[model samples]
Structures are given as structure tokens and as C-alpha cells.
Target: MMLSEKYLQIRKHSEQICEPLEREDYVVQPIVDVSPPKWHLGHTTWFFETFILEAFLPGYQVYNPAYNYVFNSYYETIGNRVIRTDRGNLSRPGVKEIYQYRAYVDAAMLDLLKAPISPKAEELLLLGFHHEQQHQELLLTDIKYILGHNPLFPVYSTTAFKLHHDQTKEREMISIKAGIYEIGYSGTDFCFDNELGRHKVYLPEFSISSNLVTNAEYLEFINSGGYKNFTYWHAEGWDWININQISSPMYWHLIDGVWHTYTLAGLQPLAVQEALTHISYYEAYAYASWAKLRLPTEFEWEVAAKSFDWGQRWEWTESAYLPYPGFSKAAGAIGEYNGKFMVNQKVLRGASLATPEMHSRITYRNFFHPQLRWQFTGIRLAK
Candidate 1:
């Protein structure tokens, strides 16, 4: 696809994800981790304006000077902006205004792409495309969070998304022979900097499940008092469950002794056959402990990823979010993307249904705090 076409398609998809949302839904940030839908729309546009239009397009006019302060997300080098927690507090530059901002920037971005562009500008444009795609995934999940948390448990769209149903194949472990393996992104494609620095790691033979842990399987854990059993949980995970009174995965509810979960399609009976999602790394670890198994390391996951079907959920790995042997940050605000976030987070391999098309490479390293379960996270066992 042409660069301009790809840009428009991605930009449109972000807005399309929000089509079912009410104006009120756009401003909700139920938790510090979930940015409001409006914020995502504006922040993604600001990325293009700041990085591509302003930096590359000569005499390009910024749509709104104040948007830089409102939409700038965590580039310390990019100057001060709204903190994550306070994103929901702003009511001005409301949903309509945010959409207008998107249109304004989209026009300038298209104009810039019409002419031959320098390699640096093209690089930033591609990065901006993927960056917006990242936000597109967030937009859907955030919309789910906003609607799912409401007492009404309102539906975002009746047909837009369906929870992943259970795998039909019988569960089995796929054996991987022990060997030194090349890890990290090796392809000459657009990948985040964190996926670079390809290096080798030695691994012993291991077996990983061909299927993700299903809701029925997890329900067994719940019935067996998995949440109550501190033995299965890490010390910190145990504390998180207790302090937050977390008893089940996010959006899960036991109503009249039946399990139901909130989805974009609205509150519905939990399909035990479906792959489990909205789980934290802590939950994944504890569940693995209870099953007398362990989660795969990221390297093990990459090696075995081709052997099984994935992309149903973001599978948690038993690896910390750390840089590779030769990892180095790209200089400037872009450098702040992944390198600095390499602490206190766990690596999640594969991809979730919420992930955008062409965005789920095996080397993609998604990290989040261990206690966060808002994203579509799941588990696969290794031993």
C-alpha cells in the first residue's frame, strides 16, 4: 500500500473503533492505566503532527498549540503534558473537538506524504503508523474497560468483536529440543527498537502447551480456591489480590453461581470453552504454579510460537522485560519508547485479538506491570 493510503486506513480504523461509543464514553479513564478514548485519538494525531508534520513538513502549521500539552504522553524530552491519571479530568476539547483535531492533522499528513520525503521523515511516518496502530488496539480495550465497568455493562458493538472461543484440539505440549537459539527481531521490517539487538540464548529442551488455558480450565482453578491459596501465588501477587480484593479475572463476575464476563458485545454468560483472557502475569504465574507447570520464557515462546496457533490472547511469559545483549536506545524522544520501560514489568509474547493486523510479529515484546489485567492477557503452560 502507498504510505498515504496506509496512513489514512490506520487513522480511520482508530476512529471506526469508537463508532459505537457515546460522547460520555470517550472521556472515561476508569483506571490510571486506561487512557480515555478521546485521549488516544488525540495523542495518536499529536504523534504525527509533532514527529512528522512539524519536524518534516516545512511551514506545517500545528492544529492546536495546546494539544501538545493535552496529548503528549510520556516523552519527557517532548516537554511537559498531562499526567496519565489526570487524562479523564479534562472535559474541554471534548470528543467533537478531538475528532476535528484528527481531521486537521490527517490532512497535513496526507499533504506531506504526497511529495517525495527524506528517509528520516519516512521512518518517522512509518513509526507513526505503527504507533497509531498500537493506540488502535488500546482504543478498543479502553472502550471495553469504559463500557464494561459501568453498572449497565453497556455494549460497545454487537458485532464488532467476539471473545475467542475455546480451541477444539485436545490440549497437548509441543516439545522443543534444547539448543542455542537466536532471539529477537531478525526481519528487515518495521519493529519497535526493543525487538532489535538480535542475540543468542541457550535453552534446554522444554515442552509448551499447544493451547492457551481456557476459561473452563481457569474456572476449575477458581473452584479449587486458586485465588485463596497463597501458596500458588508470588508474595507480591498474593498481596495484590488481597489488597485489591481481586477474586477473578478482570470483567469476570459470578452471578447466581454462574460465570459471566463483560465483553465488547456486552455482558454475557462466560463460555467456559473460550480461551481465558484479561488475566495478569501474577495470575498466570499462580495458575502455572497450581497446575504444577511453569510459563515459557520469552525465548522458548519465540522458538515454539510457529508450532501452535496464537494471537488469541497475549500469552504471559516467565521473563522480565529487559533489553537484549546489545540493546541501545534510539536517541531522542523516540528513545524513550521502550528502553526506559525495561524494569518492573513482565514480557508478554504472541498477540491478543485486540492487536491490529500486521502488528503481531513473534518478536514483539509487550510489557506491563505484573498486577495489570486490563489487557487481553492469557496463559500457556511450559515444563
Candidate 2:
């Protein structure tokens, strides 16, 4: 299928999902983990309107003047943007209104895609599609994060999930050759800026676990006083836990000494064999240290995942995310996406359960601050 046709379907379906919600739900951020659903709807449209439509559409009309500022998410070159932490404050554009706005843009975008598109405009449109997909994934994460805090703890969707335990015995740590390993995307397909120019590095002789750390295994950590022992945690992690008086993963609850977790499908008993998720790098590092293991460096992770499917949950790695060696950012504001986030965060390998299979690939480096854990993050331990 042509990229344009597929994107149109996704675009329309995205709007359809929010149509059933009331005006209030669009802005019901509830906390920092969510953006107003209205904002997500419009901001995604703004990407096409700003990056592709404005540049390509003849006699293009800017739908909302404030949209440039309101929808510009994290593009430093694009000037100031609406505050992400305060996304709930946006109430001027009601939920219904955003859908109308989306409809107008969708008609225009489809029209443009039907006509001839310049190479630059076409690439931007493709980028816009993937950008929307990212937000689509975030839309789920953000809504779940918000609903988790609600007193009612409302369930968003009634879709059933698979919770069956895969009884395959855990594999022992497997050793891969520790020679010089070239890591990065080898294909010409679209990828984020971080995974550029396959490069070489000397990998020390080490072994990585065949699978992710399970919920059952993590239970052992808690049983063994993992949080109570300061030595198992990083200095900063310990301080964060102490200052916050942290006890367990964010979504976990201990009611009368029994464990449970909240999910989009509603609260359920925590499954032990399920991959441990929504964990910060600090906590992952600490737990690995406790188990006499280390998180694989991003290079090592790429070397390992290069053969396996990188479409699973995002794997926590030992390397801090940074620009590739001899890498240069693409020209224009789009360059802001990956280059700006190159510092103060660790690299993650593999996709999450939330990510679509089409978007996941080796050398796709996802990163977050050591203490942040709002997404599906888990560890693949190494020694």
C-alpha cells in the first residue's frame, strides 16, 4: 500500500477513537502523565499542517493562529510551545471542536497526498505519519497513566488482554562473541536521528539474559528487601526514593499485603512471568547491581538485538544516549527531534508492547531520564 493511503486511514481512525468522549475528557489530563486528548488530536494535525501542508499547500490558510505556539511540541527552533506539564489548562478548544479542526486538515491532507508532492513535502508527510503514531502510542500510555490516578480508577477500553503464563523455563545467560561490533541501522528505511551510520566498538566478553526480567523475578527483589537495601540502588536513585519515600513500582499497590496493578483493561493481579515494565533506568540499574548483573551498553544491546526481534518491549541498556560518532543533524527544525535529547538520558533498545511492529527496528535508540518511567521500560540483564 502507498504510504499516503495508509496514513489517511490512521489519521481518520485516530479522530474516531476520541469522538465518543465528552468535552471534559479531552482536557482531563488529571496529572503530568497525560496531555489533554484534544491537544493530542490537534497537535498531531498541526504536524502535517505546519511541516507538510504549509510548505506544500497552495494558498494554505493557518487554521488557528495560536496553534503554532500551542501545538509546537518540543521543537526549539519552532519557537515557544504550550507547556506540556500544563496541557490540562487548554479548554478553549472543546473536544468536538478539535475533531472539526481535524476534519478540515484531513480533507486538505488527503487532497495534497492525491496531488503531486515534492520529495521534501513527501518525506515530511511520512514523518508526520510516524510522529502521529508515536503520539497514538503515547495517547494510550498517557490515558492509562491519568486513569490510574483517578479515585474511580475508570477503565478506558473493554478489550481483553492475554495474561497467560508462558511456562518455558528461563534460559541461562548466553554469551555472544565479544569482538568489535558495528551497531546502528543498516537499512535505508526511515529511522530516528540517533540510529545513524553503523559504527564499530570493542565489546568486552559478556553475557546477556535471553529474556526480560519477569514480574515473578522482580517479586523476589521486593521479598529480599531490594528497596530497603540502599547498597543496591544508585546514589541518586536512593535519594529520589528517600526524598519520595518510594516503596515499589509506580502503578503497584499493596492492600493488606497483597499486590495488584492498574491497567487500561482495569486493575488485575500482577503476573509474575510478565515482563517488568514502567521502570526507570535508575531502578533497573540498581536491580541489576543487586543481582550481580549489569545493563548492556546500547552498543552491546544493538549487537544482541540485531538478530532477534527488536519489536518487543523497549530494553533498558547501560549506555547513555548521545549523538553517533561523526554524526550531523539534518537541516531545519526537524533536526531538533533527536539531537536535543542526546544528553542526560540513557539509551533503550527494542520496542515496547505498546509500539507497533512496523515502527520497531534495530538501531532504533529510545531514551529517557534515569528517574523517568512513564513508558513501557524493562531490563535485559547482562554480566
**Model 1: runs farther than 4 Å from truth?**
none
TM-score of each: 0.99, 0.94
* Model 2 per-residue lDDT tens digits across residues 1-383: 77668877778656655544545567877666568777888899988888887889898887887889888888888789878887788777776777788888888887887867788887787788778878876776776677777767677666532322232455667788869988777787787767887788998887878778877788888889998999998899999988988778768887777888887667778866777888888789888988988898888777776444344467788888888887788888998878877888888888776764377777778888888787878888888
lDDT of each: 0.91, 0.77
What would you estimate as the lDDT of candidate 1? 0.91
Provide the lowest-lDDT 10-residue window in model 2: 159-168
Clashes of each: 0, 4
lDDT of residue 113 for candidate 1: 85
lDDT of 2 at 72: 84
Off by over 4 Å in 2: 16-23, 160-169, 306-310
Q: Under the 3 Å rule for N, CA and C atoms, how many clashes does model 2 have? A: 4
